[model samples]
Target: MGMTTDPFSLLGLEPTAALDPAVVRQVFQERAAAVHPDHGADAADRAERTALFASLNEAQRCLSSTPQRLRVLLQVRYPELAASHAGAVMDGAFMELFGAVGAALEKAKAVQSRRAGVVSALARAMLMADETMAADAVMGALGAVNDAMGALERALPALDETMRSGEACGPQLKAAAARAGFLEKWQAQLRAAHAGAVG
Candidate 1:
């Protein structure tokens, strides 16, 4: 999609982070259908139709996720926010938690690799036992990640209020975006552990 059209505009919604998923999905489906090249557009217009359809799909995907929606909203509303906070350092306490999560993820990843490499039933059982032994640490890491995510979620209402009031919110939005990034990455790591255990 062109930088000229932000995700909200592409999806025909007001530019806000707290969008209703149902509304976004409905708008996305409508827009997707309208721009789809298969809908009897002239053959010569296929390129334009394809681009529009792709843009609509991209917009829908971005706005459908909370982190992505916030990031895009910040990008559209405060272009400088991303540049200023792209590398904002997490506070000491958060960093400690993040480090712990990282260590646990590494352990989980190693276990998953070992599990994948072993073909013998006995070896698989042993790996499962090892994973079971490490369950507490993995769970603790997941708990920390969830707590951090909760903190991020609590900050959203204040950010939204600041936006609604037409106040300067570049710092708040940027911080939120950064925290969202951290949470998303941590959650993915935790998901890998869960997937390994289930598989």
Candidate 2:
């Protein structure tokens, strides 16, 4: 399939910002099984099945997350709007979470640096309390990120309703997608920091 192929169409779903992840998974599983290369009757058939299977997997990946799904929905339905808002600045709410995550990551890096400088076992042992505190801070930041993500997911259904009503929700959808992108990035960073602190 081409890059322009609509993932929702590939998965036999309507193009919408709100989709239940479980439903997407179930549909992908069923569709993938039917086109699986292993069941192909000949080499040419198998090759075709392989390509289709890959497209199905790509569709599943796109629809599996709220942010990605919203992006795809915008690209497919309102390409102009998506392009226009591509460089829009993040709103105040996301910036606050960004600050918290940044601080936690910095603390974790400091703890890791201190741990690295210690040569003696006793010195390393002495740094355990500091490492624990850093880990705790990382975990707290991760919780805040997750909470923000959850709130975004919860708002999707209403966003979908607005779109269905023929209202202009392009800006709202773009902002939500941008915020989700930030939260997703922060979650990864925080997890890595937590691992460094506690590993």
Candidate 3:
């Protein structure tokens, strides 16, 4: 409850900031199928299974976007991030990181539209950048992720609007999930890099 230390790991996934909906859904189905109450009719581990199921779901929702995922991570590591949202602005370093993440997300989206495997590539870029990026650069990348996350957050409405307009929602949702995976990977890399260097 107190930030759920290592929330990503709670679901048996790696410590990452963003998550691939496909993978998340896949894993959830696999795990949930095994642990769901219906499957646990004769088990004493029902409570634990339920907890795991819930954790998996929480992980999916929190890691669904860069911003939401970042917020959860920051809540665990930098509690102050939540505080600064009221009137005060994020630190300059954070602002820069947010911008970089947003731009990367846009690129990732384009790559997704073309059916390119952009998640690994985008993640590789972030991972490679991690080796030498300054704190400011790291924060900038995070900021960009936040921007991408903003785009993701707006998707629910977009999906609704698209449906109301008679456009297909399938392609757009797929693309958004793809880009979201990239953002998630980038955030994980950022956290990993930061922890490696400074933690």
After TM-score superposition, what is the CA distance of residue 31 in candidate 1 from its true location, in Å? Answer: 1.6
Give me the runs in candidate 3 sitting further than 4 Å from their true place: 1-133, 164-166
Number of the top lDDT candidate? 2
Ranking by TM-score: 2, 1, 3
- Relative to the true structure, how large is the alpha-carbon lDDT of every model? 0.78, 0.89, 0.55
Q: What root-mean-square deviation over C-alphas does model 2 reach? A: 1.5
State model 3's lDDT.
Answer: 0.55
Q: Model 1 over residues 1-199: C-alpha lDDT tens digits? A: 3545888988879887677778998998988888788874588688788888888888888887778888898888888766563576678988898888878777777787787789999888778777874565778888888888777776677777888898988777776777787788888878778667546
Candidate that beats the other on TM-score, 1 or 3, i.e. the better one: 1
| Cα lDDT for residue 27, candidate 3 | 69
**Residue 46 in model 1: lDDT:** 81
Q: Write the per-residue lDDT of candidate 2 for residues 1-199, one digit (tens) a residue.
A: 2555789989999988878989999999999999999999999999999999999999998899777888888888788997783564777877887888989999999999998889999998999999999999999999999999998898988998998899988888888888888788888899999999997
- Best candidate, TM-score-wise? 2
In candidate 3, how many clashes are counted?
13
